[model samples]
Target chain A: MVPTNIKNFDTLVVGGGIAGLQAALDLGDQGYKVAIVEKDASIGGKMIRLSKVFPTLDCASCITTPKMSAASHHENITLFTYCDLTSLNHEGQGIKALITQKPRYVDPIKCIGCRQCEYICPVHVSDAEQGDFSARKAISIPFSTAIPQLPILDVEHCMLCGQCEKTCPTHAIDYFQKPEEFIIQAKTAVITTGFDLLPVKNNFQYGNGHIPNVIDSMQMERILAPHGPYNRVLRPSDGMEPDSIAYVQCAGSRDKSMGVPYCSRVCCMYAIKQAMLLSGSLPLADIIIYYMDIRAFGKGYEQFYQNAKAMGIEFVKAKVARIDKGENGSAIVRYENQDGSGIATADHDLVVLSMGMIPGWDPRSICPVSKDSDQFITSIKPKISPVLTNMAGLFVAGVAAGPKDIVDTITESGSAAMEAAKFMSNSHMEN
Target chain B: MKNPDNDKEKEAKKAAMKTLRAQRKDLIASASSRMKTQKKDIKAIKEFLKGKKATIPDIAEGIDMPKDETLWYIATMKKYGQIVEAEKEGAFFNYSLNEPEKTQEKEEV
Candidate 1:
């Protein structure tokens, strides 16, 4: 009896993003005992970050809000949002997962999302909501409309200041909060730990960390958002309204010599969108896009590209060779307008590297599966099975499986959820 | 204005009007029931719509209403006529229903 916190469940979904949320909903509807463990303090993942999703420009928040509510209120779902899956060990007729929950200090049961603590906390850090667009106090809301309507104290940034502890009318602050660990016994596990944007730290040739005006595709989204810092186009370095913005497509994808080899499906379109948004947001701004191929594949995507062109967003089919610092807080982006053509340089007030999806670094690091050349979890094995790993009773979905859009991710998620459920059902029969 | 044939036409017109009235009554009844629903039920509608399509058969099965009645009410509420768009298969019937505008009218206490 190794302190068996063995709570019983049929299927365990790791990750509380849309894919995980979808899987849990499907399984729970099928009358199976299901649970979700989210590493974040709240559920909605990168989808929440998006201003609007494509193929249909429906507001992302509008779509995700209901799913978030459903997850929070599901009958069969036992959601542990601020928990991490540390280890997966085989146990009684199934697998047992060691889950570690970070302390919010505020008891979710007792803590009414009253923002007294958020305003009082003096320890400020980079606002993740702003995508490091600006800094915020440690206890602030993750976003303006974060689900659960609660605040999390960043223990790393908190400094144990006791300033917040004294101000709580609800007495919600407990600086001595301990990490709670429990074992959830499940017949099968589905991993939807989703993607991370490949970092700009490594690729210095594109100005990388060397230039402040350069941003990632997600950061561009945040900047373009009405809620974001500056709420419009302002170069990070000078705080001046940018005149020219250059987009370097496939910064992390389709470059085997530097980053992942696959052409990240979303980058080209996101670049186009950001360009269109930039031109729309600032009518006079000059926007130039450097790309290998303009991959506007989905329905109405080509029209969006054409719209961008009509709006004076210049599209040059080229591979950016380098981005270096320029005069007056601008950056110089050099590229061949077409393959191996004569090189030319364009100076811009700001530049954006359209980043690509990388596999969940830590969770994928924890699981027993081989990664691909792109670091995405392998979809098919030598045994002719999709999403099969060396380990049994484990599956992956969303960008974890490979590069996919939101719709395909949900469909694949249903399949993954079913496969995990099948393992659970079979295990139950055997037991 | 006429004799037996006119009387028969009047009777058929009355019957068609009767059907319309019955369907409209059902639609009104559906609104009343939806009004009594909690905020959670409205929330549940969003979640339920994703998985359960609220198809004519499913609605009939769920509320234990006749399929014809369910179809009639749904069609009237949707402002679409009885849809023959997708032919009914063995167990599933593919039909389109316009989502009724959720009225804010109050119900009895």
Candidate 2:
């Protein structure tokens, strides 16, 4: 028999990114009880980490934070941050999900977001929230705008230090905290799990992340952010303001050797956006983008590309073959100019690779959702409704279905929510 | 006067902490060693910038550390308010140790 302690909800949203937040808010505002299970401690996901969106140059946080706040503050929504979905299966007319809440080592109820423990902690480690470009206390909130505003203790580096314990006003520190498991029974489910970048270490042609000043697109975003590690655009290798910068497009995409054959649709535009931001910040610097093809297919995208070109940003139609370390913390780009120039090598103060995107989660063993050739969730009726998955009452949206931009992800999220609501309504009618 | 049950609970907690520390002895020792090395490196950089602002490459050469590693330490220090960015020198910005009074003010906050 099913446990009586199971929490019942009308809809369950997985992954708490912008897509998940949108779906949850859409259903919750309709008066349906919605539950959001996020793997990370925060719900803003990759969109929040970005500096600005493409074409509009609007602040990414400005657009994402309000949605995140709405989802968190919504009366019908329940947020399960820092959770792992053990299994999600069809149960009777509803879906049953087993979830494990990871230990924060700090009591959620007792934590007042005072940050007293963080201030007192002496151990400093690489802050992954800042792309490891800065330091954070052994116990710290993930970032300044983390939704929960609770600090997580890094047990590996904690050293059993009692400073935080002594300093915490609420006595929230608990060294013996263990993972808690729970179950959620919902009438419908939506998968909005986003994408992760292809690891730089896997591509040997790009120096396997060994060459300094050769960073990925996300790291460049953090550098461009207002509250970034350096608060300025300086190369990580030597803290130098680069006089010349280069962007290598299709670094991992369209390459069968990397097991990612599809073009990551966002890389070209993002590289151009970063180049424009860099040009604005460093007016005297030379910015070059090496690309086989520039895919500006979105609305106002072509005009954005033209604007970048008019802003003195050079677009070189070339295929970057490899990158090597250069003198004084520089990167040498070796590429074949598509203009019939045989081969050439150029040394740049910094090089940013527009890495490909891969599926963020694998639902094979956990959930029996079918995946397409690219490993994204397969949409059964893509032409009619791209949100409909093979499993009944299980809809997929955003990059979880395929590679898409923020605008498309948001639009698809709403569609998924509508489909889920319709499924629940039909199920109720049949009952 | 403390209750007997409370005293017993306190003893049990202390014993448990002792066992936990013993289990994590190796990790603690290694982390401590790393912290010590990091402190020494930061000290070397601070000493190099005692009375003068220096660029990352200049300090790396001065302290005989790799440029990349030196930059990491410098960036961390700058974030924690130990150092401040100075005037731009060519392609690099010179960094200097924060004033003693200013560091104390930051600590107080």
Candidate 3:
């Protein structure tokens, strides 16, 4: 049986990624009570996992950590991590959200955030947070810098070793923990649900992710991250420092067969951004980007793309058709060079697929919100007010509305918060 | 925080732990077995590539293991500095043992 607890807030921000965090912070600063519901154990979201943001190439953590810390420490904001929203519907003048907080097994209050229990655990599992290039203990915190500093015991992989229980200073390890149901009431809501990269498994042209050296952009981000698994750029197939790397643009987006016809907007720039970073790390290695079009459509973005070329990064005008396993463990890229070279094939030590972005959440069954043809939450008045959703008192922001970069996502989040705040104040006046 | 009534809750937790331990014996054993096999695979792959450069498929066929599974082992070996990347042939890059820099020779592709 799940215990139900009721709470009230001025605004509810779904998805605790960058956009949600920014929205919550903006409302919280204005003295409005806000609730941030995150599906993961930590609150940093996808931005925290990123190595660096494009254009500036600044450390992503340096920018996101302070915001995460502020949100966690804010008086008006409460974080509900590792939770699932069962239903969200309009209740009278407010919104009622049914949330199920999945058990962490370890009591949040009693646990000291010490990693002693993790060290004693025997089971080892692939750490997806690190792009699965490394292993982590089954009973451990998501990362060293994970907000809330809580450890989650992976019940599926845990062997019920009493080692963690015995090692804990405070008997916080509770194996029988169950989910708790909670009801949150908010005058308005902001859907900042983020975007997810298209899966590489079913794409037959990309060798079905079987060619070991062929990785996705997210994996490339991990490889470039300072605190990443290996802490350096190395091919996953055999840990060899790659001498030549290729980026396949439009690999997952703008395809009729895969059902994603949109450009995904950010792939081209990110590919170039990563190529530049790779140049810094592997000075002698040849970095090439196979792109149909280089869309540097942001402030200082065109120059950033040109800067990469100046740094000797090659941008080949080609559409990658298929990837095959090469003789020695390299990835063979087959493509047609758009520069009048009918058909071409190239071998590179590693290939990174710039997969397109897809809407992170589908709210068909959960809420009354409608999605656009591209599957992102529909914003009825995108030109007049981009944050206004079709439903009243509900706003959508960031990539949840459409694919965008971090800069645009953060700006959109502020707009959403302001709109939500105004909606709540107007409702208060009417009452 | 310690009280006489708290003893009951502690006892319940102990019983739960004991039952869980009993149920998870096979899980623990299997985990150890998987680790052992992974270690053996890493060793075998390193030995096979001791003085030769080979692609993932070549190593997979040589070690009599599936291509997908062999990739994992080869990645682990590379992570630990047992292997280094060689030149690209056709579509794949050949991998060779990580030898001293002085003895290394650039392979002409």
Candidate 4:
């Protein structure tokens, strides 16, 4: 017999990124109860952390936050933030998911979002949300616009200081909090777990992330953001406005040695967008993109590439062989020119590596969802309906299915929602 | 009358907290040492910037520290309101110590 305390929903969304948020909103509007389980403390995902989107150049946060707010405010949607899906499987006509809510050490019911505890905390640690370019208090809200507005206490960095405990007006600090486990049973499930960048530390050719001025693309996004660490695009080494910048394309993708042979499908467009933005910010600075090929395969993408070229951003058809630290915090890029020229090296004030995407979640241990040779979740009917997974009533969407651009991810999410809704309706008729 | 289960749970929580504190002893000690070093560095930078505005390169050369680490410290201090950007000097911006009392008074108004 099922426990009376088990929460029930019509559909379960495995991620709370833009894909999951859109799926939940679509199903909720269709009058179905939805549950969104997110791994992070907030639901905005990587989209919220980005500066802008490619091709359209729209503000990523502006597009993501409204959907986040809608999903949180929707009557039929329930959010399970800071959660881990322990196990998921088919159970009698429904899908059962065992979830564990990680401890925040602060009582959620009592937290008033006043931020007094964060302000009073003394310990300062490297802030990962800002790409480790700045420091945050031991206890802090992840960002200024974090949805719950609640603070997380980093027990690893905490000094057991009684300041935050005393400063919290609602007495929300509870150092003894434990992880709570729960169960959710739903008629359908959508796997929207997103993608993570291949770590630059693993790429030895890129100086193994030891070069101070050579940073990943996401760190560049933070540097370009309005509320960024330096508040402007400055070289991380000496806080100087860079006189020359270079973007190394296919740094991780299309390289079999790095184990990610497939193209990430978005790096080229994004590097172009960042270069265009950089030119606008620093008119006199020289911006160069070293690439094997420019794959402008999407609508308006070709034009976007042309516009960047019209703006005088240099596009060199070359393959960067290796990067090394130069004198006085500069990065030296050695590349082979594709025009039959010999290998050469150039020094730049800063270098940005366009890293490839890897699967964010592995369902091998927890669930039996099948994966393609590329390691992303496989769709049984990819040509006709790409959202249908091998598991009955199970669907996949966004980067979880494959590496794709934001537009395709959003469109695929809607298709997943429709497929899930159809599966639920068919099951209802059979019952 | 209090429930026996409640008492047992409270006792278990207390034991867990004791274990956690014992485990974190080394981490706390290391953090304290780091904090001391950071305080010395910040003090040195502030002394150099007393009644003067300087760029990151200038401050780093003055304190005999690496420019990158100096920039990290300067960025953190600026975020926490310990310093403020003064004006642009070529490609770099000069930073000066922020007056906390006056800033607080202005906020109050």
- Chain A vs. true chain A, TM-score per model, equals 0.92, 0.98, 0.99, 0.98
Number of clashing residue pairs, candidate 4: 0
> What TM-score would candidate 4 get against the native?
0.94
> Candidate 1, TM-score vs. the true structure?
0.75
lDDT of each: 0.71, 0.91, 0.86, 0.91
TM-score winner between 3 and 4, please give it. Answer: 4
Among residues 3 or more apart in sequence or in different chains, the pairs in candidate 2 whose N, CA or C atoms overlap within 3 Å are none
- Which lDDT value does model 1 have at A26? 86
Q: Which residue pairs show backbone clashes in model 1?
A: none
Candidate 2 stretches greater than 4 Å from native: A1-5, B100-109
Which regions of candidate 3 deviate over 4 angstroms? A1-3, B1-11, B18-109
Model 1, range A225-341, lDDT digits (tens) per residue?
Answer: 766654556666534567788889889787776668887788877787778777776788888888888888877889888887888898888888888888867888888878556
CA shift of A341, model 1, Å:
4.8
Which pairs clash (backbone N, Cα, C closer than 3 Å) in model 4? none
The alpha-carbon interface RMSD of model 3 comes to 5.0
DockQ of each: 0.01, 0.66, 0.13, 0.54
lDDT against true structure, model 2: 0.91
CAPRI level of candidate 3: incorrect
Cα lDDT for residue A101, model 4? 88
Q: Report how far off residue A234 is in candidate 1 (Å).
A: 2.4
